[model samples]
Target: MERTVGMSRPELIQVADTVARDKGIDREEVFDAMEQAIQKAGRSKYGYEHDIRARIDRKSGEIRLARYLEVVDEVEDELTQVTVAQARRKNPEAEVGDYLVDPLPPIDFGRIAAQTAKQVIVQKVRDAERERQYNEFRDRLGEIANGLVKRVEFGNVIVDLGRAEALLRRDEVIPREAFRVGDRVRAYIADVRQETRGPQIFLSRTHEQFMARLFAQEVPEIYDGIIEIKGVARDPGSRAKMAVFSNDHAIDPVGACVGMRGSRVQAVVAELQGEKIDIIQWSQDPATFVVNALAPAEVTKVILDEEKHRMEIVVPDDQLSLAIGRRGQNVRLAYKLTGWDIDILTEATESERRQEEVRARTRAFIEALDVDDVIAHLLVTEGFYDVEDVAFVDLAELTQIEGFDDDVAAELQNRARSFVEERNARDESRRVALGVSDDLARVSGLGGASLVALGERGVLTLDDLGDLASDELCEIVPSLSESEASEIIMAARAHWFDGEDTAGDSDAGNDDAQTGSDDAGDSRTDD
Candidate 1:
């Protein structure tokens, strides 16, 4: 049995009021939706194409519709057009193109039409609410906001951003940190998106701007407009390099950022999982700025290689290690801060100062390789002065040596092969003995012989290299490129060792073989 649920006109008004309240829509908007739905449904059901007008009484809650007609001298259509004479009978001043809204008797709306009207109004209300929310949030871009963590699924965080939801993906969050439901967090409004699923708000904590924000929070100088952050670069969770400048000459940007005993920087570092922060003084000159960026190491000079987009920094022999940092961290940070590829060198390589000393030392080392005296001298002059250095060199590079054809290069390598091998073994052993712990072998442009020579010359440590002027080293070894000297010297200092005897038994065997061969040759001639 079908149940009879009868609702009067007043009851329908109360239902509409309840829906408006529940959907957070204004009463007027609800009324408009209902009126439009009702007229459209009724007209479609009755198959009327001519102008149909509808109205709802504000106080009485009564609904009305009528066919509209315009009184015209020339009738364009029979249904909607009426002659002036006929219209004059209804109204005395009825003239051409005047519309007449005549009320028709109430027509019972069918059940299907009523159902269609209700559905359309409800859908319209929802669509309006979505549009209102989208417009409200769209104007909020670039602002910081607080959100509650709703759920974390598949490394993607869903946040309840008050009126709507936003996504805080894994990449946006700092590593190893998590948010639980109900946790209120602050993030920058990285992006706002509109789609079928409504507006998408993207939040980020790892953004470079995030670091800038943290600094702005801690530094009073920055807050008070005395200082401004020039730029920031981050390897997030590892280290960050920031360039800051002060408008007022009285304020030292680095000191202001460091705060007494590092209080200011420590706060930012704590939020970033103990990540190291380097606050550099910003300079208008790119060269000076880069030198500052590669801090804790003295730079002898900077040569900008514009074509390669790299800066070659020449440091003192001792400063090379510090300038390059452990595992190239210093140079890497410098690059990040300055937006340039960095190649570090010692001052000796840049200037023509240490030529005699490096050549004298290089000759001693290269002659031990069993190569021709001229080649040994050439190797030293060209900065390939050690056996291991020549071994590390590619065949193509060795061919670059004057008077060295492919065959001569091959012969040179063959003759000096044992020396190179022994030298490498000794270097490794020395590295272990002296506790030289760098991955310098990975650097393509540096020579192991030059590094060993640096070590032998008492430039045995990164601290030592970091202290020497890059120009001094460049001058000492005029044949070696400034970049090549810097690389080896820097590597040596980072992985320095002393009291290493890598040259022990290996050198003994080589000397013994040479003596025995001479003895054998003399014996054969006598027989």
Candidate 2:
């Protein structure tokens, strides 16, 4: 009966409102879904072959159903199209490719039809809700949020964030931390992934950024943008370090973050289950910052190996254990905080190593520069480690050293230069005997030294040079960059294919001398 369509018009709008509010989606979207469901149902009853359409009035909740047919010159699909000649009976001025709509009477739904319609509507609404949730939470990444622990399955805690469920995985939570139902939770929005099932809102309590955000919330100076958190490293519920900087010189960043009597840090520690926090002042100098990062331990000296991004921290023997912490946690966190590899040593160890390095440099200078032990020791103490430094330094810098006159400085420099010249000549003579190409030295990137070095490695031809990689070239000659090596290699490879046709022709000539014009095995068989 027609009453079945109109019986619950008010209930239809009410259900739309309820679903929109519950799903946190737009109301019009739900109405659009309902119309699509009704349209699908209409197609089932009217005939699946027909183009059935349905629409509900948003204001009055009135439903309209129609069967659409396009006027065509030829009847291709009879169920969806009507011939122009046949359409003239319904409308006198009908044209081809025009949709001819026919009003259809509403039909009562069977139980199966109603169930299918419900399923379609529910599926469409669910898809829309997922899209809405993804759009809502995608921009909330890197933000802190609060929710209620809805439940815990296995080890993953599902937090109900009012409108959506966020996942706090076991590994993302601080170690040994647990939660139960109905407990309040706070976490950083580490990631928000829109998956096929739904939007997975991943939360994290152990992330370094989480600690940074907590400081921003607890410290007003950080929130007001007066102080900035430069970096943070966490051992997660055990220990952590936060580096802060103050734009205002008057306000100390460390004092501001620590608050009065460590109130701010204590609050963050309480949240993290008593994780000891060291709020260190960030410095522009890496050595200074490393010293600050390794706090509560007196640093006697810091030796930096900048090329390797490593540091040697010399502490008092008694403070060595304190600086390293229990199970090397302190030094490990310092490495993370400063982005440097660190080695902690006592002053006694550093002194022994320093003496050994001095002895080694003295021996190297005595052998290379042909100087006496006292002069070699003097050069080493004056920071001249290699023969190249002695040869290349300013003549005045060498003369300025104690117990060295202009004649001595001149003699040392001349010997240094002569020693290098003799070495290079010897390397060059070996290179010439090795049959290394003179054209290799002609390449601008390959200097005399690099060419001789390559010759020593038995790289003799352009083809061999081209076949070599950039890193191989660098390993042979340490001064060349990869780009410079690549340029020279590509230049060497330029003539590789140039002589290909001639070489192939020569091979063909050799084949002409064969017993037969065939492959090697066939030629042998003919012979």
Candidate 3:
């Protein structure tokens, strides 16, 4: 039987190699694990008090356990309590306190102990393999890799990643992109996690970097560094925005991506399942860049508020529908790409633009005023229409604006004072008969045009304004629809009534009459 143990060594070696191969562990690792487990079991089933060591002979299929003892002058522990005379009896040449390594016969561990040892060995081997796999794949994150679809489990796809299986979760797979069993697929190695079951390899194709990688693969210009993608934003399966720049001035970045008759972009679009791709030329100037971002729609102006990182984009009246896109998609993509909040408006909606232009022209006429075309545009943003409008503005309102310090604001206040005094003098002379104040004409904050409109409607004085019904004002002002007309009338009446109330407390007897008029006004305004 002892001879047979040595002769059948090749069969045992084959068994170890097969087990190691199946478990993806080194055969030496398995043998080492087995030796450790056997030594531990020997100490557990026998005694730790007895010194023990174990070794497995590779060629003999034999496991040897040896118990050792020191030849001591006096015995202390009974398990290894051999005296010098006792140790000399066994080894014959032992001296005092000399270690004696005595080989023991192969001891049979019962079925339960043997099974436990096997389980520990197998678990250790699996743990070693798992750690090795985890380390190998953990370094591969963000790299593109090719693998075969091995199987589908739960909702995740199990891919054979050469040395291990990678899981492609349902969410990680691109929309409408399918994988068949045994079919080769390319994906990005997103992550690797070590778990008790094994190392988990994660693969992804829907990541934003995946799109860049795909472009790098298909577009030689991008790969060769002739064209650079500056920025990209995507609403997956619907729309995508890419800003591209070119190293070669002659090469149009958008045209290069579109290819001949939309071939290149079509390929990428096909991969993304008909997702709309908008390719825009990258510009150093933010204003021009924004206009490029909102293409197929002409922009009248792009006003950048750099402090807020926002854009007030104005398009022509006819181009509003196109610039806003179907449900605001065009401007939305532009906003996302530029990382700015875009407020879109039409040129027609900017009612003060013409007046702003007149103010800029008037600045050339006014000496000591250093205003340019851009400042004129800024004035419109500040709601200053024409030079006349500026003539009526208060110093307080001017001081509120940025860069309009107390000194500069005071200068504007002085300039308006001359025009204001002249107009006020003329109106004060006519105050009793015409019932008008020249100060009203010089007030820029309120609507000077609305005052003129009220005057044209036979509102000659404050008393006339107080007497006019709000519904009648609504009917006269074509621009002021019913609700807007009522608001204006009530405001005018309140201004007139406030003056009347301040004149006398004895007018308290007319309180009921004032209340009746107010009720009538409220009824008309509510309509």
The candidate maximizing lDDT is 2
Superposed by TM-score, candidate 2 places the C-alpha of residue 354 at a distance from the truth, in angstroms, of 2.6
251, model 1: CA deviation in Å?
3.4
User: What lDDT tens digits, residue by residue, belong to model 1 across residues 265-325?
Assistant: 9998987778899899999988999999988798877788765577888899888888888
The digit string of per-residue lDDT tens for model 3 on 399-491 reads 788777888767665665565566556545544344445544433322444555556566665456557676776555454545555555566
Q: Against the true structure, what is each candidate's TM-score? A: 0.55, 0.82, 0.56
Candidate 3 regions exceeding 4 Å error are 1-28, 48-110, 147-162, 175-186, 224-227, 246-263, 350-527
From the highest lDDT down, the ranking of the candidates is 2, 1, 3
Every candidate's CA RMSD: 22.8, 7.3, 20.0
The candidate, 2 or 3, that scores higher on TM-score is 2
* Weakest 10 consecutive residues of candidate 2 by summed lDDT: 1-10
TM-score of 2: 0.82
User: What TM-score, to 2 decimals, does candidate 1 have?
Assistant: 0.55
- Summed backbone clashes in each candidate are 38, 0, 0
Name the candidate, 1 or 2, with the larger TM-score value. Answer: 2
Q: Best to worst by TM-score, what's the order?
A: 2, 3, 1
Q: Which is the better candidate, 2 or 3, if ranked by lDDT?
A: 2
Report lDDT per candidate: 0.75, 0.88, 0.73
In candidate 1, which residue ranges exceed 4 Å CA deviation? Answer: 1-31, 48-99, 102-115, 217-224, 255-267, 305-309, 316-330, 347-527
Q: Against the hidden true structure, what lDDT does model 1 obtain?
A: 0.75
